[model samples]
Target: MSERSFRQTPHTSHDGSNSSRLSILLFIFIFIVLCLLARLVYLQVIKGPEFSQAAADSRTLSVNISPHRGTIYDRNGNVLATSVDAMTIYANPKEIEDVSSAAEAVASALGGDADEYAELLKQDTTFVYLKRKADMDAAEALKSEGIVGIYYIEDTKRVYPYGKVAGQVLGFVNVDDEGVSGLELYYDDILKGTPGKLVVQQGGGGIPIPGGTEVDEPAVDGQDIVVSIDIDMQSYLEKRLAEGVSTIEGEDGRAVLMDASTGELLAIASTPYFDPSNPSDSEVGSDSLKTVTQAYEPGSTFKTASMMAMLEAGVVTPDTTIFAPAELSADEYVITDAHERGDMTMTARYVIQDSSNIGTSLLVENYLGFRPLYDKIVSYGLNGQTGIDYPGEAAGYLSPDVDTWPLITKYNVTFGQGISTTPLQMARFYGALVNNGVACTPHFLISKPQIGETLQYDTEQIVENTAAIDPMISMLETVVEEGTGTGAAIDGYRVAGKTGTAEYVDEDTGVYAKSSYNLSFVGVLPDASTPLVCFVGVNEVPYERNTTEVFKDIMTEAISRYRVVQSD
Candidate 1:
């Protein structure tokens, strides 16, 4: 064969082969393109509505199911505060085409004026909350009106069934159902349930399609809390204390009943307390949980600590005699007894019974002196915060340094002047006296357990001194039987307590004000067994003489309410 013919023949065969390969590749590419086009058609037309609806559902408008706040119950499982399902009214301003008409319908149905509702509906925002925590009846009425823009969102409304009974202690929630004060604020995380999300498709009119829906994450409810409080006793104490405050015409008062052994706070109350149900109606001044938060000079009630110090330092005994006259000089200040006792020599028990400043000052000076007395007070947990579960606890003012002690410091401290202590701190100090001199840190919450069970937190005994407690208990008993706290005596129960009338200091002059005083009574119930330690303080009382009355009312009510026996 010729060379040219051979080259041309090979070229022709190569061209034909290349063309066939290109055609096969084209066919495969066309098949893939056709398959893709078919899928697009199926998704856009044949099954488009279902898929598109699903996509739209994926874009969710959620109503937050704020977890049901955990129920707060007393030790006996009496409900203090609980969460209930309620409907919250919200408006989709975008959906209201006829603002005036929709607003008029909503206003008539929901008991509001039409103009206000119309203005709310005309706002530019997509969502506007009309009212949170609406009752079932109100929600139903609004639904019946068939207002175009209005919607109901499910939410948890905090309900304090007992109302003002434990208002200060239970605390109420704010508009958004968030705890704003009291236990509600303190235990917000634990009590606030986890919020959930709801996913659903919105139709043409922005209305949720129920059957045409997506996935929903159910909300987890909060765990319940069982407090150390006793509801019956708490209610009784609140009622009696309120009555006493009103009758005495006292400015304000607070009372706390605690289990001496366990440091379990049985009942806590403050006068002018707010009702958690209608928080809007509550006065701001009455909202404080004063028992654990407010501090005041304990007055002669602190003599218990002084007596303990003296006994602990081996300075005096129950029978040890001291010349408890009208006044005794300590440092540059002269401390005098409430009543003049000429040149009377009295035992330590008598001194406590008389609530004598002279006797206590002399006794403290003779035995504990300055350093030891101050140290003992600090040891008794007086100078520091009690570390309670409640919030806003004041550690109180204890001159950080004794060297900075004023000239009258020693004398003032001898009789609970120049010192400040919370009611809870005083109760714990007294608790130490009755509980074999072991000062346990006081706690409000009994325990925080997992869902369905109650956990009991262990009591921490901060101080253990057996030497001083017995003698102190004896002295406290004497005060109840024959001392200034005689009015605190219960028929069936032996009581031990002290009365304190602390003069408030004039802010401008830094001197004791003659007209103002904080009257307080600190006592231990069932004197023989010494199970409960209670402290009631009324601030800015008009007369110091009425201090004993405050003690009597609280003690009597507490004794009768708790059924504490005299002998036991």
Candidate 2:
């Protein structure tokens, strides 16, 4: 209205202002369009693959595939330990429509509590393991029921065919097939094969897509292990040893039979042995293979090593005699024969044959000396592990300070009262004694793939003076023939053996128990030149009971199985 007087002037002003406003609006619109275009380029070019991968990852799932564990075979191709094809029961809880019904179906097939199965099926998780390494037959039975969301994957289960035979030696595995003890633990790496994988795309409702992107990487199987254990022999030994131990009502017993020439561990057994099939029921320490794992004062069994030392060192001869008294005092300890007797003159042979403690003491203290005796003890592996293939071998106890040994300690070690040794060590010692002074390695593994260093047995001469072996063996023969080990004698076979009746050391007091004794017999069969070393020992007997019955039974079986020629 005011512009009526100056209409022309006002129109120019308004037109100029409107033109400037339009120009500013056009510039803002163009800048916004350019910014949107830049954003499009950045997303489509720079972040495209990132988003695509994220979307794909949301649709994929990966699962591990277990490889087949290798089989364990005995020397005669008998299966000792092996893996059987099985199944792992798993479930998709989210996909299951009727959790209660599905769980009942699974339990009915797998033979479990339906309530427990229901608890598992009610989980919010997409994937759940209903049963790991379930029996194949059981899983198949479950599959036949066609339970919704229940599934199975291939797996393996370790099994021992021969129930309790060689159970401790064979050891047992966990639910995942991992070895936990004995040879199974010793060779776990070789037995556990490399695992594989299954990568598949998850489709709608989190179920595996059918005919969708899937990749399967095959598993590499483990290598097989072949051991020297003869299943038949092991089975026989286990039965006889258990029977023998139970008969006397002895606390426990252990027995080992070895090849005199080869040092191969033919059979090892102990009372109250483990059953690999039911490892959960085994005693805490019973999983140990007592033949190698347990060490105790060997009594007269250890005398053979020291006696041989005396002969080799020229301190005594087979014909040499020593005055063995009914009693002798060395420091604070009293030394005496196991049986009460009057003082008598005895040859070196009688010291071992009669299992005379006083006689053995006189030789070591008066002639062999502590230092030489200690050296001999180590040489025979009485004070150390024999490097057996088995795990947890006890390195026998021997005092390092021989120079400071008490006179009684020195005396006691000569007769195996102070020193300790395992049945396996004693077996190996006898093997070397009869095999021309060469000790073959005590082993169970015969052949296997070279995983690490090849297994080598120590064939070094433990008995340095080979000449002394024959004489020592002669004395051992007399023991079985007429000495304390007369109970070990077998008809029509010239057997050589030694009896050990050392008192058990009190676990709490560290002193010899008054009533308990570790009764043991170590022997060789046929003759000294060709022999089979057998060791049988029992613990905590009420009185001295001969372990020879067990030895005779086992040896008789061995003679027949090995075709050992009868000694004339």
Candidate 3:
């Protein structure tokens, strides 16, 4: 009877239990939602700065602002080597949406391979430099195309407007605007000014957004370098040397022009020279930097130094007579003149004019003892390095000590046999005699402080001997007028000079060989005022060619080009 009434009630307690279970599930869900909200709040508040900073870092861009490279000028302020502002193309590989298209565009404009450019653009890199140090015109042409992902950077490029005129001396720079060789390498720090930086905001693919201001540090330009090289003289010397070398058919030739009074190197030219603008194209072993760095037994050129020593030591006067023959024996070695001479008594002028090895050796052995002669050689700047502003300079070889002297050492040294010296040293030594016994240091840079101001440079007197000065001058004059160096004689110039022919030592056998010879000549013009002195060395002459003839052509051309004349 109670069952019928309960069925009608439909289990109210069970319904209440179901409602309680649903409430419990709702409470649990609410609790889970609150926990997630708390985590979101913690992340946004506690770790927010770190994430934001990371994002900012990703968008920040930095650009390098290259400084202007220094300008190279001649002594007269004529621009030789200069730097100009250039445009360079760069790319953000990550921003290149259409890698193939962008690379094809760039490759077409630059004459490179499209596949290689495309591969570069596919890299996951912030920057990929496409072309560096491009000229402004080329850069503008590329910019006009409006290629995507292509950007430009301003850089400085070293330019030699004279082409290869003074290329060897002026030097060259690398793609990054760094000095690579020549004067550029020697004075790199002074020529390369300080670089600056720019900070800007970048977008997701590493591309800088338009209207984004850049925080930039301006670059500093390098100072101008003025060299003592005369462009006209340099061009003339180059032309002459090239012609002479071509004519000799057996040897390479080089020449140097210097200011006899001040020892300022005016022009130094060597054949088979490399172009500074394209040094890679030059022959590897050619006379690239050999003028100052190369040393050889100077043959009779050293006779000038020996003559100066004899005069300074009072061992011989200009009129002092010395007997010369074909050969003379000193110790165990026999010294011979370039040409055979009979029993002849000649004056000091005659001794040098004939390039008499026998006479010069006798003066060294009988008159000026080993110590005095060696001291004179050292005093004339033979044993030390010339402090020229160049790289890879060498201190020429001299007898280490008198004790190490071989039996033939005195005789050999007398005629420039056992000793060696550089062309620069020879020029300076002879210049001292021509410039009133004041040996000035040879340099390439002419110091001109202010524009339109009187250009001034210091001169160092290496030797100061007044008594024996005049005779040395007379002897040098005789050399040009009626000496072995007669080929160097120029009309009305009163040329003072010396000639030399030395045997090159066989590198493998370590013995002197007659087959290979070095022909050299040194001369000073306008013997009165001594405005300029010149030295020339030609290497590896064959039997057919004469070294003296080469000297004549080079000297004549140089004198004519410089418009030099002897004083009245």
Candidate 4:
């Protein structure tokens, strides 16, 4: 090396640069180690439990177990509706290989459109329901197709034992096993039980892991409810109603039989009935429980309320006379009786016995007046709901302005034309007429008989004044003995009832139809301790061959069953 270059040698400079590089490398290595240690501490100490829980959750599968729906029984302990073990068809859309093919197979086996099932199977979620509460045979057929994503879940199906017997009153459940109408819908919360869950380890393909620990939470079954319905009586009523509806070529009919003393419903039947098991097959107007849901002008049957009001006011005695004509003009509207009885004089009792429209109208115009008559109707629960334990009950229409009410409204309401009422409401009101003037609230739930007990029901004294009711019952008794309700009489029993031929305004003309009539009859066994009150109404039927015989047939059976005897 040259002497001048020895002072600043390239080798010395290179050595210094190498030493500095090694120090920098060591510092970087130490810094990286510290960062690694801090990261380890954060993962192990700070977020360890949360990550572990997330991982556990990812592996666990939670499934809901449906509980058995409550059993519904008639008062005689016959099962009306009950839940049975069935299969619920479901799908794992994520696991499905071919949506169209799966949908086709499922729809073929289960009786639905392929397009609907395909849409359900194409969902982004892991689980989708194809059909809930499917029949075993159909669900099994679908399962046998060997579709990977298709699954079957154990579930309950509500089944009506008697099919169309008490279909309207008992109602039917939907595909999800939820009650949609009648007593079933009224007490749905009580009938539906708590659902439980099952948790187990799941694999990558959503299958249960081998030897995976399963945790279960058991479901609580719903409480059994015993209704005050008599299955035999219900069947009897339905048969008679259907026969009457058919015999007269009527549109439909409704009937209700009740224990007059306790206000407990014995039977409720409606014609053109639907099968509760296959509610979808029901006709448009036949699905409702007509006894409670359908309200119509009661026609001459409403004369009873006028009679009660007159009797209460002490304006008319049974022997008090009225001049009733075939046609009478009131409020410039001409009203007519059923038959042509040109200007005849009859007793007040005979007015009811004859179902005279003019006589009733005169009674309201003279003694009872408008306001007092309306008040009496209100007192009898005519203008309001009867408080029966049923859904969709109609509160009958009374004139909103009673004080300045038109004379037409007054005359029509007197004979049950302007006002409206349900068969159940009429039955309940008539119960007071027979039950010593105490109108009990009608109900179907007797008790939870499964627990060996009876449910307490509030029996209301809707009509406490017996002064009028006693005489009114006598009048009704006379009517059945020697009046229009003669066909309603039983052989050995003294029946008390009234017949009504109600008129309806034509849908086409908006005027009263001359041919259409709603024939109705209501009867009660006056001598029995717990009187059985029966009501029958046939809609759009001729008065000649309508519900009168049906009433007789039902009451005849009731007299035999209750052992009613003639004291006379």
Candidate 5:
């Protein structure tokens, strides 16, 4: 065979194999093209509505619709705290051109520093807050500038119309519209209403689409809260208490006035208080309320309890006589009267009138046994919280095992020296005394029944039981008439109360401070059947003067306000 013929045969066979391979490759390419075309058709037509809707949803932006917070009003219908319409300015940094120039223009309108806002506008984020709760006029002026990427959201800023009057009682809310302290924190749920939402379409580059499809859910405004605080009386009490603190050169002072008949708290004032409108500027310790929160030894004021217990237990009558000395050594502690006096026989009424510690110890140790006396004092709401509608109410500390009290504790507590009590607790106890043994729980909220609504809080609980208070009332009236509480007496009204001078322990050394005393006075006007109870306490003050002047001034104002008639 010729060589050319052999080479030609191999070449022809190779060409045939190559042709088959080309045909298969062409078929596979055509199949792939057909598959891709079918997929495109399916996406564009069969599932087009669903896919398009999903893509549109991805471009939509959701915004929170804030609700308007409630207004807080005092019992006299004075606005304490309310919300004002404001604006929140924001920017989409990505959409802004010339960040520096845009930031400056926005800052000029907002009345803010330009460099700070420029730094915010230089961010890579889609959104940044330029100013929160800006003035409405300022925000409107900025919007009128037609600056790109800047937007405004409607917001409500809390404002206190009566600045710093009841600041501690009416708490402040944070930037997020959350209550941080006082009544605001207590009624937060009722004040913060339900928030709604808004959804709107936006372009890929953070530009809002013109006439974009929007779904809106309107927000529900919060309900209004009316508290039982008498703004006028509250103001007066604050003024007097501040002056009293300054005059005594004391650490702090607190006062509470309550309607004895209904147990409605008229006023609760504390010195060194903070204005809730701008809580950021207030020091933490200054804002603390001492009336319901602080507890101290009640001193001679607790003698009323011992006297009452003796009368109730039949251990002694008003005329029952006891030998009282200047000093009586009981257990390891030596108990003494305010002033040195020779041993003399004194009635139970005289014992309280003179504020005699020795007489009180004799009555408790001999006449009224420890158990019976302790039980009687417990009945007066001494060792428990007064259930006031304020935050951080400390139930005055009392050892639970009063039935087995030590001799020193008994002797000290018999004259209000060892046991701790709050001004509120003492006021309630005295309220029970003046009300003839029926006293309601001290409360701040006056239950206002909205049409077809039930109140969230109840104000009717018997804090003190009906005991024979007529004799005690007469005895207390004698105290103000001729005893230690003369400074608390009104000209025409029959005032009943007791004076307290308690030595407090030094916080740093944990021992009794010779100079520091809590000078206090609690009084009640029992002229008519219904009484008005008032209590004032000054901390870390010398006992040169009692807190009777504050009580007198406050009660005089109260009598005029309530039109209290003078009794015989």
Candidate 6:
């Protein structure tokens, strides 16, 4: 055993142990560095955006400020619809510490289920509305609660001052103050203005920081609109039409009154009207503006168009006479008069006065043919929608392709038995007659471009000249004096109009109902000066007579409102 060998062995062992220890320490240091680098990448890249958004949401509160809706006014400056300040309750879900407790507080204040509100409070969104257009008292009470994460934003709520006076015309808004029907929907673009934004710097728990950075985009309020409806007249018509429907044993009633020359709708009424203030308090179909949306057969009221056709073609004069039997057989269908009558002779005036379907059919089928009558009606704006400032205006149906019509169709259309029309369209046609054969576009909004958007004034010559209206006017006067529309006569006023009784075509059967009938009357007051057309119709009327008296009541009120004087 040499001293050198012992020393070498101990050194080798000690050096090996030290080298192993150093290698292990270096490996551990490298592993820890790699792990830290990966954690850093995750925190800075993958989860960075999430954390940044959460922090931002807690540090700043951003909200949308609703703009004020435009006011709706009638022709007489009556407020039909308007807006008022309201509050919208919302929650900052990101800042809510206890979702259930916050939801319970909101529900108790707002009269809602706590579980339902809890679901909304637990949403992933930064902002959740507890209630839109909330009651002011309720909102104030909740504000006083000092609940964390609960906030409110100022908003606007729609109000109809007249309640149901012009519900179909004014319509109603949803909780968001958005129009959903009628003229409100038609002019929603002008009624609903641009929304603005508000950003407020906040501290922990979404609490507003005093004197913090605030950015606001001012809201642009909606422009006002003026329509032609007379609020007082509209109210009177509403009451009268409801009464008319009940008295006639009809399911519903509708009417339209307009300036004969200007085409401005003065009053529109429908039974079972919806309340614009409380939309839920309405019947199913009552929300619809039936005057423009629903259409039905016109019956003998359409004879005016045919009478014009005969006069325009020079086929008949007011004195021209025709002999009609009890029933005429054409196209294998028996055509009879509106009232049961034996063989009789009738002049043009008498035919109109009596509403003689057979006589009109004989004259049209034998003398003027159907083309002139069809063209005359289409020219008077009865063939399509009147282009009114209203939503859901239905275009009245007219049979096309004159050559394709059956022989009976020609005669039936002359008496209005086979034609369908709307009350608004009928009012428009009558307006043309009163305008001496010039059809003005029917509308509710008057042209006021300086204040808001409006359509251009337009007119069309329905006839070559005024010659075609002279004889027709004389006969229309005769109708109210002694004809079927005598009930529509207004004392001391020179009135002219026509009556209509049409069979309701059942949807299930696709044919005329045995007992149901649509009764209607259209009249014009002071046929010469400042004429106003009043048209009324009732659906599913069981009686033979139409709504002639309803027209009288409505016209009486209208004439009184306009201060119309007595005429010879």
Q: Which stretches of candidate 6 lie over 4 Å from their true place?
A: 1-61, 93-105, 122-126, 200-215, 447-456, 566-568
Question: Tens-digit lDDT track for model 1 on 185-290?
Answer: 8888888877777564566545655675444777888777878888887887787777767766678888888878878888888888888888789887566788
Model 5, span 416-473: residue lDDT tens: 8778888888888788766667667887766433323433433332323335467777
Clashing pairs in 2: none
Best by lDDT: 6
Checking candidate 4 for backbone clashes, the offending pairs are: none
Worst 10 residues of 4 by lDDT: 4-13
Minimal lDDT window, size 10, model 6: 4-13
lDDT of 3: 0.76
The positional error of residue 542 in candidate 3, measured at the CA in angstroms, is 0.9
- Prediction-by-prediction clash tally: 2, 0, 0, 0, 1, 0
lDDT of each: 0.77, 0.82, 0.76, 0.83, 0.81, 0.83
lDDT of each residue in 1-568, candidate 3, tens digit only = 5555434555445788899999999999999999998888877887778888788878877777788887888987889988887887888887778988887778777768999989888888878888888888878878888977788877777788887787878778888678877788888887788878866678866788886737578888776678888887788777777776676664577688888776677888677777777777877744256777777788888887787787777878888887776677767667777776677877777888888888887777777877788888887788787788887776888865887787588777877888878888888887777676777777776653434333455555655566787777778778777777677766666777788888788778888776667878887764544367777777777652445555566566656666666666
lDDT of 4 by residue, 536-566 (tens): 9988875445477899998777677666664
Shift of residue 319 alpha carbon in model 3, Å: 3.4
Q: What is the lDDT of residue 352 in candidate 3?
A: 87
Candidate 4 has an lDDT of 0.83
Q: Tell me the alpha-carbon RMSD of every candidate.
A: 6.2, 5.8, 9.1, 6.5, 6.5, 6.8
Q: Which prediction has more favorable lDDT, 3 or 6?
A: 6
Model 6 per-residue lDDT tens digits across residues 322-427: 9888898878888877678789888999999988989988988878877777887787777788888788888878887778998888878898877788988888
Off by over 4 Å in 3: 1-57, 213-215, 285-288, 329-334, 341-347, 448-458, 526-530, 544-565
Q: Please give the distance, in angstroms, between residue 147's alpha carbon in candidate 6 and its true position after superposition.
A: 2.0
Off by over 4 Å in 2: 1-57, 212-215, 449-456, 508-510, 526-530, 566-568
Name the 10 consecutive residues with the lowest summed lDDT in model 5.
457-466
lDDT of 1: 0.77
> Which regions in candidate 1 have their CA more than 4 angstroms from the true location?
1-60, 203-215, 328-334, 341-343, 447-453, 458-464, 506-510, 526-530, 547-550, 556-563, 566-568
